[model samples]
Target: MRSPKQDSAAFTQAPEAVFEAALGVLQNAGNMTLLAAHNGGRRLIARERPKMSNAKFLDIRVEGDAGAAQLHVTVGTDPRTPKAMLDGKANAKVLKNYVASVRGAVDESSPAPASPVADHCLQKKTEVPWADAGQDPEIELDGNIRAAYGL
Candidate 1:
């Protein structure tokens, strides 16, 4: 494990170099959906989570050698609709190839660097008041039930 200071330095330096290498690794993976990726060195570890559904979720992790990296990605399907996979018109084998192509693009190595200006940006916190949910009361009373209860 690296100290905080060491990690910070690794992240601040050339991050893209590592990612490019990892991209090479993923490009060779046979059949898998590109879920997420990670990249770093002795000092830092950067990871990215894939988007979910039309909005879904992708889980991924990577473990790299002192100079290399490893990755774990989980692919899921959407119940509401099939993504990437179309109707019968789409070939099943072609769909598999398509997913492989995307997985190849994922590089579990160095990630994109943060903008220097981001370090200087100030963040503000705000407090919000909570309100109770109001309930609606609009229903016709049953004459028979009302009569039974003499209401």
Candidate 2:
């Protein structure tokens, strides 16, 4: 059997909060279907939508308290058939992008430390969305959950 690809990262937020952010990030990435959500335990199991990919599933687990949290993510591909296996590079890219999105969400939720005027200006300029007038901001996550999560 092939081993699943795995990655972990620590976050300076409550485990529950980080779990919630992760759910949002996964849903936003599109074509992910939640298979199980253990809210009390801060764990979720999901998979790429059938139409999107047939072989990949994701397991996300969180642990820690209000002061700190750790997230463990694993990407597994079905081993019943050799052709269904996912490549290491693809799995690593998925994990990296997911972690970055979750981190960004956490950062956006918390207030940043005070910085110089010029620094703040530059940061805002890069992060701000300059959507066209009268057009809605891009929706990264699809479906009703996007509204429920306020993403």
Candidate 3:
């Protein structure tokens, strides 16, 4: 029997938002289906049943109110599934991928206006004096390395 794998993460968005994003990411993932969703997206259950592969289960739960949330996730093969049918640590790997996908999904939907920090990155960089003048700034004015280094 394969043991369950679990992980959790925190996000800046609301619980509902994070839950929905996770659900969407799972939906886009191949061979996964939504088994159920309850608590207005605060709790969800999904299954991964690939052809000729071990079936896996996923559970996601979200907590917190507005503007802040925590997401908990679990992945595992069915207990009844025989050991021979189990794939080693596949659940853990899948859980890691799921968490990464959910993180990307939650963070992808940015607010309309760019934050100041992000806007700063989009601005053109200032030119350096040495590069603009095509000069080797590392060398001394007279190209004397010993004098520059006080050697």
Highest-scoring model, lDDT: 3
Over 30-106, each residue of candidate 1 has an lDDT whose tens digit, in order, gives 43222222232211112122243122222223344445444333323222334453322223333343234333343
Report lDDT per candidate: 0.27, 0.57, 0.61
Off by over 4 Å in 3: 39-41, 84-88, 109-151
Candidate 1 overall Cα lDDT vs. reference? 0.27
Q: Is candidate 2 or candidate 3 better by TM-score?
A: 3
Give the TM-score (vs. native) of candidate 3.
Answer: 0.64
Tens-digit lDDT string for candidate 2 (1-151): 1346798999988887787788777656656655445556566655554443434557788999889999999875534435444455555666677778788877775322311111010111132332232222222222322232222
The predictions' CA RMSDs to the true structure, in order, are 19.2, 13.7, 21.9
Task: State which candidate, 1 or 3, has the greater TM-score.
Answer: 3
Q: Taking the tens digit of each residue's C-alpha lDDT, what string does model 3 give over 1-151?
A: 2577789999999886787787677667778865545544366656687676577777778888898999998887754455543564788878888888888787784212211111010012221222211211222222333232221
Which ranges in model 1 have alpha carbons more than 4 Å from their true place?
1-53, 78-111, 114-151
Worst 10 residues of 1 by lDDT: 1-10
Query: What is the clash count for each candidate, in the order shown?
Result: 11, 1, 0
Judge candidate 3 at residue 6 and give its lDDT: 86
